[model samples]
Target: MSPCSSVPEAAESVSRFTERPALQSSKTLRAAGVWTGAQQTRLNVRHFEFTADEPHKVGGRDQGPTPMEYLAGAVNSCITVVIDQLAARQQLTLEDLQTYTLASQDTRGLAGTADVQPYAHAYRLQIAITTPERDEHTLRQFAARAEHICPAINLLRDANTGLKVVWSFTEQPTAEAAERLSNAAVGYTEEHDAPKPFLTVTNADLAASVSA
Candidate 1:
């Protein structure tokens, strides 16, 4: 299906959120995981079930993507979805959107051989889009807004992970253009500022009222 096929629905959802602020509320997400065997985990979230495992080099069957790979995928998917929704809300004609994500990690931390961080140190996303707006500044601002609202991107940024995003825009999305984009050198790159960590607060008054 065309990427813009859901724009109408996205626009309607955005309108609902704008029209009714009360409809926006905190939602809890739940997921469960079970360790099957040999560095493999069976995961369940909502009605979806998937497996995560390590490769032969890590001593497990390469049944599925590793947790780190999943993390990268989550970031990419979140950004894409956010951008799509934003485009819909802005009434922008979005013909195509694609993203490639890369992460750098030090496995020594996972092996407990070094005193280093176990998670990804940095993440890079290459974003290609076909849109009617040709102004570079406008496109960058639009993407920045989407990045600001993207949850996964914020999660990594709050954790002090370095992020680099490169954007490429085209008037037409052709197979040749896509191939060039995949192998081309860097274009416009954006490095966002580090986000401030949120502070958790305890509602003593609410607790007292509940107890009473």
Candidate 2:
């Protein structure tokens, strides 16, 4: 006698249990490798430099991240790091991860021109995330969580900005030694130093025969 109930309507529950398959547990859930580096104090780029300090003059011209641009870029970079960390932890294999961001704003004479909002500028990001396994439900759940927890997603949500992502999958090769295993796969012949024929070759006998 099971401790479970046996009401007249309890037959439905028993039937469901009978129809349900037995629970199957994985024998071993491997521990994926660790991924590090989450801080971004600065960026290394030859074309530009961005710092939190006051604007610095570059090439006799003052330049640096504009307040709004910095906000947008921060969201972009944060989202990337967040996704990377989450995916790595989830043991999701990735082929390529890319984000394209666009922001729109309306200029109204620099802040003082009439009481107006900044056109409610929006930030649109298209993220291409590839996975090794095909699990639409799991992927969708991951994406939902990723969007909710990602810094960029949080920022956009807080700011009432529009945000969306286009998901895609592509095969990604493992990061292994890139050295050629064998040149024999495609052999090459060494060049030999040889005299070149500077003049065209014409058979004299053939020329005479034609003349005849």
lDDT winner among the candidates?
1
lDDT of 2 by residue, 1-212 (tens): 32333323423323212233222421222222221222222343455544432234322122345546667677667877887888889987766565545566655724557665563455555455545667655666566556655745644655645443433333443221011111111232221221111111122222333454
Q: Each prediction's Cα lDDT score?
A: 0.66, 0.45
Candidate 1 lDDT by residue in tens digits, 35-64: 999999999999999999999998988999
The candidate that wins on TM-score is 1
* Candidate 1 wrong stretches, greater than 4 Å: 1-24, 174-212
Clashes of 2: 0
Q: In candidate 2, how many Å is residue 180 off?
A: 33
Work out the TM-score per prediction.
0.72, 0.49
